[model samples]
Target: MKNKSLTFRIFINTFLVGTLIYFVCAFMFFGNLYTYFEEQLFNELESESIFLEDYVLNGDLLKLQNLETKNRITLIHSNGSVYFDNTVSFEEMENHALRSEFLGAKDKGVSKVSRYSSTMTEKTLYFAKLLSNGDVLRISCNQHSVWVLVLGMSQILLLILVIAVIISGISASWISQKIVHPLNSINLDEPESSDVYEELKPFTKRIAEENFEKAQREEIRAQYTANVSHELKTPLTSISGFAEILMQGGTDPKITVDFSKSIYDEAQRMTTLVNDIIKLSKLDEKSIAMEKEALSLRSICREVMEVLSASAKTKNLSLNLEGDSGLINGVEPVIYEMIYNLVDNAIKYNKIDGSVNIKIQEIQNFAGDRNKVILSVSDTGIGIPYSERERIFERFYRIDKSRSRSLGGTGLGLSIVKHASKYHNASMLVTSEEGKGSTFTVVFEI
Candidate 1:
């Protein structure tokens, strides 16, 4: 799980940082080793020069020669002559008196290191401290011992840093895998309860919620379409029926007038049904959203009455808006249709002196999340049969088929109301008894 691509990058990065820091620190630290060797050589030269001070002051050549062979030393005189040269002759060298060791002996009063000879590749440490007889000591070696030891240790440390980089890279792979593996399976469509990393829990919950909402929306849309199509068939059938009758017309004036009136009525019914269908479809598809502009429900009721009052007067029925109006979030066209259908149905099926009372009020619903604007149209008319009240919203369903046909009903009015409420995300409830008339309530959510 941990050995993922992300780990590889982490390992490489760590290795690089570690290696660079080590190199800088090691170089500075190892420099002290070289300095230590230089100090050792200089101290040895000082000791030898002091030992020879007593011997050289007495002009003891034999004692100096014995000491020089043991210490790898050489002696140079004040005039630049090699009296006892164990490493190289002074005159054979390149201007030893002009070199650092010679200058230190004369001026700085301390030891100095200088190159002795190219063939030997030796480094010499010179101590110019005066002997009792005034001679100098020069000790020389190749520094081969210090170089070999330090280089071997450096190689070991380099090997360790390389190993560290490798180990860290392996660990990095593990951590990267832990993060990215879960994300890669994001679109797997697994259930929320399925095994998943803790980090991905919120995402899984959201996906499930979206899927649930999608399914619910599709179900609602299907029901609305089926209901709308069923209702339109009544008017469509009427139009088709009359058109066939006209095609077979015999020349009876009374029959001609009656058939012509029927055809004209069916055609208008089909037109109304189609227009309402289109309007509801747009609302359902979300192409039309409710406009929140403030408008008086009471005023709209009067306007609806003005448009419909003549038809009511034809049957001597009274239509009135009985309650104070309220503002609602809805497109004007939808509200018009909603109110129109309820009142139209009432009037179409009412008695000679039937009355429709339009009552508007604000009420809180079950969820208490929103305030609903309700429009109730109650009629005193020939009411729905108790057994058929539920079927009224179904398309083309009419309780009194003969009477409804005579009144030029399209059978699509109630269905339009049902779909319109659904499109608005509202609800509709119907109540009626055989002789007590009906009330259709339109509940609109804000």
Candidate 2:
């Protein structure tokens, strides 16, 4: 569907409203003018009737015959006979006894009435008075009806309407332009800084926020690409050098076996790195469609301990599991991976004879409602520095790069933990003191 221009809509609305108002005012003005004219005509007729009444009373009726007037004059006898008429012969005129004006004047001394012609194009006003001599005096005048008056002045009215239309069109166009100019001038690059209408502030603010997020995402992508390239290149270089040594002949069998093992170790490191990258990508894109189910956090912690028991033993670290069997709804694999990474990191970074304590428990609010299930891994190890804690969850971000690589730490473990916790609608909190211990906590809403 095609969108219509805002300016066009505004103009049409303005023009229609102005035109309607104009017509309404014009109708009211003309209607009042017609009424005023009728009233004036009646007053004149009343004055004339008063002046001629004395002449009839003095028996000087013949003198009224010479009176010059545009109005029609009539004198009627008490018995309903028309004795005198200025515009028509009295003998041919109809009797005035049955007339409303004449009958009203006989009863009330004075009266007036208006009558319209059959075509309604003409009107006649009649004023009648009762005389002292048992006779009635009547005066009348012809007038154009309100419709006829309007028709007579139609040209002037039409000219005024045309002028109003032209003025309205100009005003509408100016108003529409004034309203739209601000919107067109907005700068999208700095939408929030643009001087825009107050109503449009929220719209501009949203755009600004989206632009900021887009820039951050672009920066992160570039950094991630660089990190992936460097990480892959290191393992590939070591494997290539070791494989070349093995291919050479006439070497000691024991040395050959050692070189081949070195090549295998590098390949295994590369495989782990590739797998971690794929998992992070899937979590980021939300492509993992695993269904959620009820699972115990303590059970998952025990499984992780079993898998890393040998690694813990090698470090002379004691792995302990305590607290309640915290149960939550989540994907099993994601939950297991997150716990496994946390425990493995704890064992790797712990001091000899130091403990890696894993705890799972459900916490309740003051209202006695279960609020969240918490899984915490606390290690008595060389802890993280406060400044480096924030960056630990970033991929390929290692606090001690040389030591991390020597311990077979991929540096993506915490990043994976972060993504998995987020997938389960969980939050992570870290608290540590250098050279003492560190604790990582994941809180899941129940």
Candidate 3:
């Protein structure tokens, strides 16, 4: 039952409600009908009793005896002795002294009473009137009890029930289909644009959100695959060409050595690219099991500068670290990778003899409480354009592809930085001019 379709449930609910209402109305109609019939019978009996009282008063016994009617007429003396009866001989009938209608008519001049038979399925209504001769005239009739009346009309009532069931079934089915049609017609790919019931707008909106996210993920996955293939192919082609040249016997020793070195460099480049891809995959998938701990941004900066110092020296770039040892709670290795990537990008893009400045500091809120730590890396380099700043953190996205490749940059550095910062509930801000320089700031809540 719980697994039934929506239409089925709707139909069942509608049918049950309709059936309930029908039963309630049927019982009420029967109740009022029974009351009306009983009242009509009583009124007829009272009128007949009034009309026949004159005949008994004028001593018209022959006329009363010859009269024909379905009702029973009885004449009782003032002392409750039966004088005459239409349906039976007065001597054969029981005494009426103890009867409620007899006593009531004797005192009130006229009275009415209903009595049920021993079987309880039949009843008799009596209207009695007191006469001028101190005798009583009674008119009586038989009636079926309420349950008997219902039983007598069982076939008609059953027919009505059948008709009701048929109508209710048709109405319920039609209504359920009308209600479910809009949901069935929803286009999952563009749910938000589909015409749907107002009550279901929130439901369709959720589907739209999921669809959008799925499309984005698929797009990113496709681009990442294509980029990885192209990036890997370049190094493989270089290594293959260099190895081929080195294999030829006529090559000079110095040139052969240079070719071998070129092959090794290409291999190293491919290795670096593979490792970066792996790191990004781990970060994206949340596959890393490392726990977060208290760490200093200043300490991490010092380590990144030490690792990249040689590369900075080659470009004649000065590496400087300033400000306090900003503390934060974060995964240590992920934090290290994020800082390393930012500093590396700075040094790689800086002009010859340019300076890469690393700063770590605490920021205070309006209440003067130091609740945030900021790490900003700025460099004197060919900075990013406003239009391209947003996409800089995309996987393998490079503004200057040739310069980026020449610098042995894998192009996933900023992407990794973005993911890692997000993992630590941090936000990254990029401020750059096309040619002057760029500043990358990561803000972390402590």
Candidate 4:
């Protein structure tokens, strides 16, 4: 019971207050009734006195002499000696001096009230008046009627208060539910705003804000996971391929020499993959501080193509730059790595004699506040499937696992391209489809 809810407590308090209020009303009502009963007793005593006086004035003494038996009337002599007993002899009982009405009536013939007096066996009220003949007429009546009336009224009041409290408790609980129900149903993780109570507006707004912040954090985490997997898979692929090559040692003498030479190629590929992945990881973690330098964007692209030209020739793909661009503020190696990855992926995945097209153009972005450098790499090869266009950049994700492994392609290439672009405040985008070819685009802030 002590563990009950706040609303339950409120209801209980309301009910108790209602019960108290009901009892207070009952007490006041009974108090008024008791006063009325006192008044009626006084009136009855006065009326009886008047009747007795009239009978005496008309000189009829014996007419209601036996009335003392029914009304508890006692006639006393002038000498303070009782002349009639009715129930007992005067000598057998104590003097009624403690009664106020007895003294008042004895001294002044006045009708008066009494102190509560009791017999050896019964409790009773005592009333008295003095006679003109120097005698005292006293009366005592049972208090049974008053006590019964009070007790019966109290019982009824108790019953009514109990019922009222139960009803009030139920109503209070219902009111509590009306306020708490809506709060229990709200979802704090989704991205939506809905109307709630005005008093609860602050809480609702806080929930919405937290949900939005949480969504942003989750998005960042997902991007990191995608970026990291691709980053790691690239180096692992080169290392594994080269290790496999070195294991088939000393075959045909020509084959043995060729395999040994090829090991160097694989090792360098692994080295490039590792360094790029680390750089991207640092950038993704925002732990790398880039020192921007002035360099021509066109010259950077051409230099990167020259380094990758031999790989393109081996794959029988044509790699060329189509436009010239002025100097851009960026770190040279970082820019070289970004362009190289994009150009390399294009050639590596191209069909025999496929062409890798590099284009650089200045364009206006939606913000309309600055010139943008758009670097696009388009290739003619096995194009991306429409469904896999967006997923191609995730780490370790390969459309054709066996073919990618055979080609010694590290799945992290495009992922590094993505992170490198982001590190340089660039926007990377892709357009592709199955059996046609693919184009990768980067928008660099200029």
Candidate 5:
């Protein structure tokens, strides 16, 4: 049933329900039929008894033979002597003194008894009454036993059941088709446009929303592809132009050397851009092998600062690391890369003599009073506007495109930081006021 299709399951369910209903109706009909037959049997006995007693009082005992074909009429004397018998000779007739119906009639004026015959295949119903001549009048009728009666009707019941099964199967197939046709006809690409059952409206709307989102993602990918081509072409064109100049034989040796140098610089920029793009692709595919170990957050931050100190010095920015030691479980290189990008961006965007503060501290949980770790970088740089903050983490996005290009910074640095933070199950919080300073905080729940 777990692997069965919906149509088959629906068919089975409908058939089962129909079968139950059929049995219930059959039981009720059989009950009423049995009751009606029993009542008719009793009425026949009563009418035969009344007719025989009336005939005997009129002194027409010879007419008793007329009723022999319908029922057995017996005459018994008060002293238990068999006076007249219709089905047998008077000598062979059994004594009626000890018979249930006879004894009952003598005491109660009228009585009836039903008993199985000697062969057990037949039953006889006897009705007896006290007549005006002080004689007991008895009428007996033979019929099939109750078990035989049930067996006789079994053939008819089996036929009805077979017909019911055919009808139920047909109905089940028709109903299952009616239920499954609309689902099969639904257009997945534009689900809401299809007219289906009212019960399926919610599912169709959900599919529509997912398709819309998928379309938007495809459009974004197209734009990103165009951006990557444009970004790569600029440097490649510059390098090609300079190489062409060198190849054509420059008039001065110094000028030729300058051209070679310019070509090298453009080539390096293109190489960096291509490498960053590869890294972004790897991150998107989640292909990086990660090993978790307990790491000192403060030490990683210090190492990032040391590597970027020369860049910070050139910018005339004061780089500082302050806070307590905090331990976290993460991939060491990924954490270092995350911190390096943040500090590098701080120095690149800061004004001369601006301060870049690194804070590593343990955060206390408000609900459970548990201790967690946080690493924050605060920079007195040209901060981002509120509108651009959300898009800043998107690949190839920039607040100041020209300035970002001039700084020799790949737009993927912040994107890498975001991916790395997410890999460690960390949350990034940003606070910035344009023309003031920005603080980027990475909270780790280790």
Candidate 6:
């Protein structure tokens, strides 16, 4: 119903209102017109009665009997006998003293009365006046009631209503168009400058905002495509060049071992990159099935630390754990992945013999209703610059691209941590300074 055009709705509403008004006016007009016509008939009868009384005073009884008129005239004696009647014989007519109009005239000098005939088709109005000679002169006429009059004019009234409906329809359509024209003319691309109703300003502004956001998303998508193509091409070229060298029979025993090892490393790096891309894609699309439950943050952190202990040992770094049991409700696999990535990044970017400290403690939440678990990985390594801290969580964004590639870093580790944190409804806070150390803390609501 809301999808209907404004013109159609307006036309229907106006037509219905017009019909209602027409009925009301018709009822009132017919009623008042009938009453006015009855009053005028009574006045005419009264004047004729007065004239007959004058003729009787002048002894012109013969003229009363021969009066040429449509109305019926009657003359009554003071003793209640009918002396003369124009429409009927005086001997056959009933006595006039008991008549309502005659009795009214005896008391008031002049009066009128109306009654419907037995057939109910005609109504008779009787007006009577008292003469100076102690006689009553009466005049009567027949008229119709308001309802009968209305029935006779019904066809003409119906025709008028039909004409009114057509006019109302055209007027309603014009009004609806005038009201909607401003809305139709608005330019969505430049909503601020468009001439529109004040009530519609918010809607137009929202459209403009959404268009800008869509454009930004498209730009980001284009940049991501180019980055993915370049990243994949680099490893493919390395593998191809090494295979060509081996095919040419360039075999120095020591160099052959080195080339084969380099080829294997490149293959492994590409595999890792592909896997990370797939994982990021699943996280981005929110397709990863999550079964939430209470999990021990301390245990997950300890398990990740044990797995990376050998890698830390190669650089002679101390991987230590602090604090106690920290419980939070989250998907176990996601929690495990988040911890593993943070710990891995800490170890990978740390200087040799540097210490990596993992802390699991509970603190009062911002709302102060319950305790929230805080898992932090702090490292004594080359810290990030303040300006680059925020961008580090973006996929494939690296502050030092050449050094990051040399270290076999895919640059998606921190991005995964960010996505996991969001999925778990946690917050990631990083504090780092150049040439010093950095701390990455994740606060999870319990």
Cα RMSD (Å) per model? 10.5, 3.8, 4.1, 13.2, 3.7, 4.5
Between candidates 2 and 6, the one scoring higher on TM-score is 2
TM-score of each: 0.51, 0.84, 0.82, 0.47, 0.85, 0.78
Candidate 2 on 1-446: residue-level lDDT in tens? 14489888888889999899999999999889988988898899888877798899888867888889899999999878899998888999888899998998899998889999999999999998999888999999999998888899999999999999999999999999999999999999899888999999999999999999999999999999999999999999988997877777777999888988888888999999999998889889886587999999998898899999999998888899999899899989889889999998999999998999998878876487558998999999999999999899999999999999998878999999999999998999999989999999999998
Tell me the whole-model lDDT of each prediction, alpha carbons only. 0.70, 0.91, 0.91, 0.71, 0.86, 0.86
Clashing pairs in 4: 229-395, 230-395, 230-412
lDDT (tens digit, per residue) of candidate 5 on 220-277:
8998899899989998898888887778884489988888888888788889899878
Quote model 6's TM-score: 0.78
Q: Which prediction has the highest TM-score against the true structure?
A: 5
Supply the global lDDT for candidate 6: 0.86
Off by over 4 Å in 4: 1-273, 364-369
Error of 6 at 7 (Å): 4.8
Please give, for residues 1-446, the per-residue lDDT of candidate 4 as tens digits. Answer: 77567666766677777777877887788778866766666667667867876665565656646565455666565555565555666577655554566667777776555444343232355566777766677765654444566665777766786787877777767776765666565666541455466777787778788877888889977876775666556655856675676676645777656765676666766676667567667667775677889877788888989998998898788887877584567878878877887887788789888899999887665677677778898999888887887677776567898788567776777777777787778888889866678898888777
Clashes of each: 8, 0, 0, 3, 0, 0
Query: Model 4: what TM-score?
Result: 0.47
lDDT over C-alpha atoms for residue 300 of model 5: 88
lDDT of 1 by residue, 1-446 (tens): 45656546655566566667767777777788767877877676676666666666677767666563445666666555666765455457543566567557656555666554554434544556534345555555445444555666877877876776666555555666665666665664544756677776887888878878888889977876786676667667877887787788675788778877877877787787678667656655675556646666677777888888988998899887876676776667766777787888888878888798999887766565688788888998888877887788766678887888678675667877887778667788888866668898877776
C-alpha lDDT of candidate 5 relative to the true structure: 0.86
| Alpha-carbon runs more than 4 Å astray in model 3 | 1-3, 56-120, 126-138, 159-163, 170-182, 185-198, 363-370
Q: Rank the candidates by lDDT, best first.
A: 2, 3, 5, 6, 4, 1
Considering TM-score, where higher is better, how would the candidates rank from best to worst? 5, 2, 3, 6, 1, 4
Winner by lDDT between candidate 6 and candidate 4 = 6
Q: Write down the lDDT that model 4 would get.
A: 0.71
| Prediction 5 TM-score vs. true | 0.85
Q: What is the lDDT of candidate 1?
A: 0.70
